[model samples]
Structure formats: C-alpha cells, structure tokens
Target: MADQHTQPAKLYRMMMPDHTCPYGLKSKDLLERQGYEVEDHPLTTRDETDAFKAKHDVETTPQTFIGGERIGGYDDLRVYFGVDKPKDQQSDTSYQPVIAIFAVALLIALGLSWFAFDSILTVQAFQWFVSISMCFLAVQKLQDIESFSTMFLNYDLLAKRWVPYGKVYPFGEAFAGIAMTAGALLWLAAPVAIVIGGIGAVSVIKAVYIDKRELKCACVGGSSNVPLGFVSLTENLMMLGMGLWMLVRLLG
Candidate 1:
C-alpha cells in the first residue's frame, strides 16, 4: 500500500483567492488528518494565478489532484472524508522513526544538561575558530566574482592584491577555509562548543553527493573533497554561536 504519511507532492506554484482560501485550508487540514504532508503556495493576484496556470496548465482552484489528474475537489473530498476513509483510518499506521528520533534527542538534551570541566577549553577554541572564519568570510563576501570569469582570474588577499585571472579568488578562498577548519576542531572541547563542526560535517556530507558541482569549493577544489552550498551557511551559524559563547563566558 502507498504510504499515507508521504507528503502531497507539489509540482507547481499556486495563487489562491480568499474565497478559495477556506477550502484550501480545509483541504490541507484534511490531508494532514489523512496523514499526508501538504505544502501550499497561496497566491493573491490574478497575474500570479495566471502565471501558475500557464506554468503548470492547471484548470481550476480548490482541486485535489496528483500526477496531473483531477482526484476530486471539495465535494469529492467531503464524500471521501465522510465514510469510506474516516479521520482515524491512516492514523493507526505507526511512524516508528519519530519515536526513535525523539529518544535520541532526549538523550542528547540530558547529556548537555550535565556539567563538565572542559567547557572552558571549548569556549576558547570555539571563539578562536569563529574570529578567524569571520575574518575570512568577510573577505570572500567582499570579493564578488562571477563563476565563468573565475575560470580565468585570481585574487590574493594576504599578498593584498588582485591578479585579475580566475586564480586569485579561488586560491585566497582555499587558504581562508583552512582558517575555518582550524576553528571547527574546537568541538573536541565541548562537542557542541565550536557549533560549526556540525555544519561543516553536514556540508562535507552534502558536497560529496552533488553531481553538477557548481559551488565554489573554498575548502578543497584540487583535492578529493569539494565544498557544498550549505557549508558556508553552517560555518556562519556555528561561528555565531561560538562568538556568543565567548561573550557570555567573559561577562559571566
């Protein structure tokens, strides 16, 4: 049987009218009740609605369809929900993973609650990592370069100049990433201390799976490891947490 908990697959964006809003909200709630995740693109203007119609070739509003066929609208939905498929029909199917994930999260929370001595070392290492990364990222964001032009130009920050070829930005970014990596190693002190370590790990995980590989590999381009898009986001968030930790420690 098809998994009822599978989210409703949305293939197109939609602009909905206020009159249709009630029906749409009801449909979404019912979908959730039946154990499907529903995502909606509520549209406001006629132009926006027209754009969606043009884009996906959808005919009407307040419709329930999957794989481009009209499943049924509110009236059909009313019948389905009325008797054949009751509200609790799919609720019995256990989503066992949720229980497992919750257990793990609870364990982690308890571990974090316990006091530890190395928390100080964690704070120091995390702050050092954040400072260096902030310096590097501030520089990279400042060095805005086009992807195609990067094939021919380069920039050097430590040397304090631009070479005008693709070489400069990439090389400088690479060196700067080493600074971020150094910061991430602070996790040994608190595991949660540097904060950036988790993001870096996830980024590294995602980068390996990408096939087109368009993102700037600030960490290791020539080497086997390639940088992922989220790597930078994770790095920034981690550094922010680390910096906050330092301020709190110093003041407290």
Candidate 2:
C-alpha cells in the first residue's frame, strides 16, 4: 500500500499584487494537516487566475485535486478530511447567532454603564442590558415581519387569533425598549411590557411544556434557529421584571 503522506495534492490559489486568497492558505494547511504533500500552484495575477478558472471550468479559486480527482473548495476539503464545519454556518437549527447578539449587547451595556456611572454592575446597568437586548431582538424581527409573523403564529396564541399581532409585536417591543432605555414614558412602556410579556410567557409554556411541541423561537427573529423554549421563556420573564420594576418606581 502507498503511504498517504507521499500522495501529492495539487492546490491552485490566488496570489495577486494587492490580494491573497485566505481560503488558499487554509486549504494548504488542511492538506498538510491530513499528511498529504501539497503541490502549491499560485496564480499570481488576475488574468492568470481567470485563465486557470476557465480551463478548469470552475468559478472559484483555491481548487484542490487529490489522487487525480478534483476535490472542490475549502469546504469540500474539510469534508474530505472528515472535519466538521461549524453547524451554525451550514445548518438552520443553531442558537449561536442569537447567543452572540445577546453576548455583545451585554458587553455594550456594561461599557455604557461603566462610562456613565463608573460602575459595570448596577441595577441601572442590568436594566440597560435588558432594554438594549430587547431592541436588538426587535430589529431582527422587523427585518422580515412577514417571516416573523408566520413563525410566531405557530406557537403564540395571540398571534394565531389576531394575526396582526405578529406584525405589530416587533414595533411594540422596540417602542417599549426605547422608552425603558431613556427612562421615560413609564406609562406606555410598563403596560406594553407587562401585557406582551405575560402573554408570551403563557404561550411559550403551553406550546413547549403543555403541548410538547418543538418549534423555533421568534425572539431573535422569524428566521432564527434558536429553539422555542427556555431562552424564549427567559426573555418574557425579563420583560415582566422590567415592567414591574418600572411601574413600582413610578408608583413610589
């Protein structure tokens, strides 16, 4: 049997005057990692790269050939080496993107609070974190209201009955968030938060726990892959807390 390490892999990648294809370097590294001796072919100019692509009848660069067979691009190379590309990048059922947005919003909230009050952890900072996170999530929903409404109707009892509630929900969430962030319009923000949050909590619980229906969450957006359950429930609970707190402060 021939040694796999002795097998040569041919790689054609772009190397121009002003740009170098990063995927090409990645492919080379992967090939080496897989114990293959790589024959690097650098297309040094635009015309050269274009000509090579034309000859190979392929559209993209960093093409790989192993054992006298075309192995496609960087993703294909990973597949060949049995390396799993991130599921979030290729699959639809991933919570990583929503998690990332919340993570960033938390950091921003802490930074803003520290700059304004000289403290990273405080009641006001926590409020800001929830408010900003709400706004961010609302924006995602607003990007595709139609899609959001469809997904929302699957579980939200109010959305299923009224239908327009799905369309109006994002705007209401955004308005509540903005009002809370500014520490103004407590009358409007508090009621809006309480009503929406209450309904959302009940709807989520019934769908996930009672009916045992597994579904996607529309908290981050209509198209999000975040599962509809714990995270969604937590979001509603946070809103409830914010609303009650604001209402108490106003009353006191």
Candidate 3:
C-alpha cells in the first residue's frame, strides 16, 4: 500500500507555447513556500486544457489538489492555506496610501525647515508641508492623466462642461505646486490654486452632500479606492487656504 502522507501536491496548469498562465506560477510558488512538493502537470495545448477543465468540472486553469482533494485555483489555494481572506470579507475603502504620502511630506517639510532655519516649528515648515503634499498628490494624478481625468469627470462640474479641463487639471496642479515649493511666481500660482481648489471643494460638496451620491475620489489617483468624502474635501480646502495665504502675503 502506498503512503498517502508522503504523496506530493498535484497541480494542473496551462503552459502553452504561445502563452503561459500567471496564476499557475503563483500557485507553484505558494506551494513551494509552504514546504509542499508540487507535481506540476502542464496542459500544453488548448484542447488538452479544455479536456482537463471538463474532466475536473472547473472553468479555470491552475488547479491544485492536496491530499487527493481539489483546491480550485490560485485564489482558492490562497484561502485554503489561510494566506488571504475570502473576496466577500475584503473591504473596498483604502486610505493608507494617502496617509503615508502626507506623513512623508510632513517629515520632509520639517527636515527642510530645520536645515534652513535651525527650527522645525516655523511657519515656513507648515507652508512647505502643504506645498510638498500638493506636489505629491499632483504626481499621483500625472502618473495616468487619462485615467485620472476620466475619474475626475465623474463629479467635477468644470470638467463636465469643458472636456479638456479634466486633462489640463493635473498639469495646472503640478505647476502651482512647483511654484509654491520654490516660493516663486505667486502672481500665476495663487490664482491657479485658488480657482482649482474652490471648484474641487464645491464639486465634492454638491456630489457627496447635496446630491447624496457615492463615488470614488480622484484626489490621490484614478484607480484609488478612496471614497469621495472628508479626505477629498480636506485636500481641496487645504489648497484653497494655502492659495489665499500666499496671495495675502504677496499683496501685503
């Protein structure tokens, strides 16, 4: 009689000449990391893959079987091994990225203040923090202008009427942020920041409060899971405040 305890984990995955399945590689890596010996069975042809799927009554490739019991696909295997939570349990909201960016920007601002004036608690530090945060946020939008613009149009009143405003928004933001960081060109930067920030704040309030609509925010990026709520509102308010402060200083 064969020893069932010593039997290796069996994995069937698609590995055709034209294409290879990524999930298959993930499944293999996961099993290896868990100290399991994988007996990989590659389906080299479409017909062979179809036949395997039909025989196993599964719709996808990269199927795993441990102790002679089927373990569906890569995601299924992850759940089986307690590596990930089930899809239904996962939360959609994520604010960690934005928090991390702001935190880093604050530290940078403080560091710069200490280096320049030998103090970290100066008003200049606060201004630097706001400007640096804006720059970071602008960079995130610039990563995928098209995607950011598309998501922005969902609630931006100006973008809705003027289609090109969505695309131009990121560049404008970047220019304002850079000018603020260098403490130069308040003539142009102040107005740009004021207008954009005012518009953004009003749009967010109308969509989320007045209209009672739920949507994703484009503050961080297009693919961000951050909801259109307090954080988004705060971002715009900060920009508006910074712009006003800069304008006052410039005039006085």
Candidate 4:
C-alpha cells in the first residue's frame, strides 16, 4: 500500500498553447493548499484533450484524482474537502451582496467627507451615503435592465400598470442619485425620487406585509437572491426621505 503522503494527487487539465483553463489553475492551487503533492498532467492539444476525455469518461478538463479515486472538477473538489456546500444544499437567499454594497458606500462617503471637510461625520457625508447607495443600487439594476424589469413587474404596481415604468425605473433612480449626490437639480431630482420611491415603498408594503407574498427583490439586480421585504423597504424609504429633504432645502 502506497503511503498517503508519498502518493501524488493526479490533476488532468487543459494547458493548450493559446488558452489555459482558469478552473484547472484553481484546482491545482486548491490541491497544493491542501498539502497534496500534485502530479500535473497538461493536455496541450485539442485532440489529446479529447482522447483524455474519452479515456476518463468525463466531459470537462481540470479533473482531480485523490488516491486513485476521481474527485471531479474544482467545484466538486471544494465539496469533497468541505470547503463549500453541495450546490443543491446551498441556500438560495443571500444578503451579502447588498450588505457589501452598503458597507462600501458608507466607507466611500466617510472618506469623501474627510477629504472635503476633514470630518467623517457631517451632514454632507450623510447625503453622500444615501446618494452613493442609490447610485450603486441603480447601477445594479442597470446591469441587466430587461431582467430587472421582468422581476420588477412581479410586485411593482406601476410596472404592472405601465410596462415602460419597469424599463425607466433604473434611469430615474440613476438620475435622482446623480443629482442628489451633486446637490444640484433638486427641482428635477426631488420629484423623480419622490414618485419612484413613494410608489416603491407602497408596492413593497402591500406585497410583503399586506399580501404576505414571498418574492425575490430586484434591488441588487434581477438574479439576486435578496428577499423582498425590509431591505427593499429601507431602500425606498431612503430615497423618499432624501427627496423630501432636498425639496425642503430647495424651498428654503
């Protein structure tokens, strides 16, 4: 019987002249990190790779083998090592993306404040935080507007009434965010923010609270798993508050 430490893990991956498989590199790195002596096998040509695939009865490169037992691809290796949950068992809900965006936005606002006024806690910084958050959220929606619109139509009253509103929502949020960030064009920004934010808040309240519907939020993007509820409500309320505040400032 071969000693576990003495036996090398086998890694078969694509290392073609023009293209190297990233997952193959990742698999190699993961193996090395786990203290395995890797026996690297590079498939240099398409024909050679195809032959290897045929022999192995596998469709993809970056196949890993530990102790003569095939461990599959990088994702599979992660699961094998308990580094990641199996795909089917992984939770569909995640707030990490939204939390990350807000965290970064807050940091940026504080940094800007210190740069401008030599103070991290200022009214301007608060404004920056909200406006920056709005901008970031808008950018997320704009990434795949069609997908966002489709998701938006699920619960948005205005989107149901007027399909174009779903398409136009991100642009309006972006416009309001930019104008508010600059503290300019309050006349335009305030109304855009107020209307959209007001509608959004009501729609969310009705859908999540009143109707008790379980839906995915399009806040961070169409494909995000962020649940439609408090986080969505907060986003709308922030915009509503920002718009009303700006309107008051403009009137004053």
Instruction: List the global CA lDDT of all models.
Output: 0.44, 0.89, 0.91, 0.94
Error of 3 at 105 (Å): 3.7
- lDDT at 169, model 4: 96
Determine the C-alpha RMSD for candidate 1 after optimal superposition of all C-alphas: 17.9
- When 2 and 3 are scored with lDDT, the better candidate is 3
lDDT value, candidate 3, whole model:
0.91
Q: What lDDT does candidate 4 reach at residue 71?
A: 91
TM-score of 1: 0.26
Window of ten residues with lowest summed lDDT in model 3: 1-10
Candidate 4 lDDT over residue span 1-252, tens digit each: 335545579999999989999999999999888888899999999999999999999999889988899999999999987899998999999999999989999999999999999999899999999999999999999999999999999999999999999989999999999999998889999999999999999999999999999999999989989999999999999999999999998889
* Best model number under TM-score: 4
Q: What global local distance difference test value does model 4 have?
A: 0.94
Q: Name the weakest run of 10 consecutive residues (lDDT summed) in model 2.
A: 84-93
Candidate 1: segments with Cα more than 4 A from true spot: 7-20, 54-59, 67-70, 79-252
Encode model 2's per-residue lDDT on 1-252: one tens digit a residue. 146557679999998889999999999999988888899999999999999999999999999998778988998888767686653556657888778878988998899899999999888889999998888888999999999999999999998899999999889889999999999998889989988988999999999999999999999888888999998898888888899999999999
Q: Sort all candidates by lDDT, best to worst.
A: 4, 3, 2, 1
Error of 1 at 19 (Å): 5.6
Q: Using Cα atoms with residue i matched to residue i, what is each candidate's TM-score against the true structure?
A: 0.26, 0.78, 0.77, 0.93
Which whole-number lDDT from 0 to 100 does residue 91 have in model 2?
66
